[model samples]
Target: MEENIDIEQLRIPEALTGPEAADFLRVVEISRLVRMHTWGNDELAYTAGELLAQCHDPYEWNVMLIARVNGVIEGCAGIAMPLDDNTELAHVTLDVLPQAEGRGMGRKLLEAAEQFVRGENRKSVLVETNHAASALAAAANEAEQIHPTSGTGYLPLSSREARFAFSAGYELERVERFSSCAIPLDEALIAQNMEATHAPHRSKYRVHQWLDACPDRWAGDIARLEQCLDRGQSPGHGDWDIAKLREAEEFSALTGRRTIVTAAECVADDALIGFTSISILNHRQDVAFQDETFVELEHKGKGVGLRIKEANMTKVMREFPEVRTIYTWNAPGNSQLLEVNAQLGFISAGITAQWRKDFNAY
Candidate 1:
């Protein structure tokens, strides 16, 4: 028999200074491990300070809830709502230890988070679960081992999260492919590619590199590209109030991050037509997350996308010696960017499904 657990919100100052700090971090560690094991994603081991920062953010509202049974932490949930646009939308994320499943601990944590959102008058909720290809493959192997069916062959991918979300009344909205590559990328191969693809257009455009901040001259140009990305990935049926983006935000000082950006400039007009960037947190120097990569409509078909990526990869290898892996996401329909990633040596890691639910429906 499993014991019922109580869910409590982990507040900032109290969680940091009080006697429960260590326990809070322990819960986070277990949740992180469960995510990695179940989703086949990167180990995003976050620190207490980072967690506190989210709680104190001015532009976003966040809450972290921990579930405990007899004073032992078993699971946790994260709730967030953007302060600006999409005011009615709240995002929820929950993770439970593998051995703790079937205990209803996850459901309890989620109910608390959803209740918190209702208190804030948020009418809609969004959540995402990453499905790794490795996990699916492993499940297929086990299904075959147990017994083989007819032409159906293997069992469809199933997860505790999907079932839980469906049971709680969430609908699948979209699915994005996850890809990654071990860094210190094969320089010889990329160099050869650069020569064959980007060399012919050398006189037309030039590549520029920066760390943490974009130059003053390119601010406006970069802002436009950022907007392009916002519109490019938006779903037709998605609901939203406003889109606030700026170049200053990207260059703003961050405590424990080093941003590396590579952009392509058209020589004729010296305009920043495209860019790609990766950020490495101080505590996780070995892992870099691909933030965004964009090329303006006018610059399309000239290989600007590949050029910036290749240039940035070269700089990261030389500048960030600790970087070992880079992870990225792409909608399967975006074949162009996917091809560029594949050419740069990224392999499919898994699938990421976006889920949403309207409070009115319930």
Candidate 2:
């Protein structure tokens, strides 16, 4: 919408197979980095081939766009349409160089992404924005940041991304806090925590871990656990659907991701009760992510979550020695897991707010 700014659709390989995908992947990698920069974490990056697999993934078809002003790719956008469930919903994301902020570039890129999503007959679209809470909360909007809704919410209106989303009539649906811990691979500290965690639950459960795929023994029970991930979540989300459920097939589609899953099994029954996973790409091993860490409802207070996380983080310490820090997200309402993360030395790093805009409502 702004002069000198041009948003053009960038076509990834129509048939994203074979050597020709290499050229397409290079562009994708560049675009993904532009988005990652807004996270303010340099160690966060995606490999060209990994992102290539994502672009042409079978579970969902993703659309990419590049925004330029004077012929420089300063921003990019991605639109995804799911094939399994929630077909009426589209997910869109716009990323711009930090230096390129405040020039109406993000709003322009978002508009371009929305136009593409609308073309697919989507009824609703979801987007997420991340801002450093401490940084912004301290700057100004402290009171507004303390509030939960858009007019005054966790996301600072002073932020460029927040301004664009709120001005565009996007509703703040959910606010999630991002936390991180610097891992020195301190064996004694980890051992102490694991010992204390095992003190109460040792007689009932034992810890086990796997490299990538979820083991056959744990798959079914884990599926049951995953189903309740957002069961009693806070209300800011739009029309709920079964689409958020993670299935085994989805894991297979993430061929480029390496998942380190740690679980606690009942010693007597061999049922998987608690589990945590840290997934990362092999090419970018300096950083890893906390995928999912859940303990079954009945077994929650028995320290299962703590032991599993400790075991998995300890595994990262032993195996991936180069990894400096691990990042994880939790809702402000999730006091249980938040306490676990705090005990694990994960301080608040940033907050990512999920916002939704309904095309049909308006």
List residue ranges in candidate 2 displaced over 4 A.
Answer: 1-3, 13-39, 145-153, 230-254
TM-score of 2: 0.84
lDDT of 1 by residue, 1-362 (tens): 65659899875455566675777677668767886786565456566666665666676798888888877887888888888667899988887887888888888887888899999999988877766686767665443221111111122335655667767877666667788888888868787777867556777988889887667677777767666666875422122212222323442354466888999889998788889998877666788888788888888878889888878877888899888888888777778988898889999987677667889987
Error of 2 at 290 (Å): 0.5
Expressed as tens digits, the lDDT of each residue in 1-362 for candidate 2 is 54588988876765557775644565555555664665565565556656666777776878878777887777777788887667887888777766777788888888888888888898888898778755665656344443455322366666766777788878887778888888864667677676777665678998889877666666676665565554543222233333322344355445656778898888887787778889776567788898878777889888888878988988888778888889898887788989888878898877788788999887
C-alpha RMSD between model 2 and the true structure: 4.3
What are the per-model numbers of colliding residue pairs? 1, 0
Cα error of candidate 2 at position 162, Å: 1.5
Residue 60 C-alpha lDDT in model 1: 76
Q: Tell me the whole-model lDDT of each prediction, alpha carbons only.
A: 0.74, 0.73
Residue 12 alpha-carbon offset, candidate 2, angstroms: 1.1
Candidate 1's error at 315, in angstroms? 1.4
> RMSD to native for every prediction?
5.3, 4.3
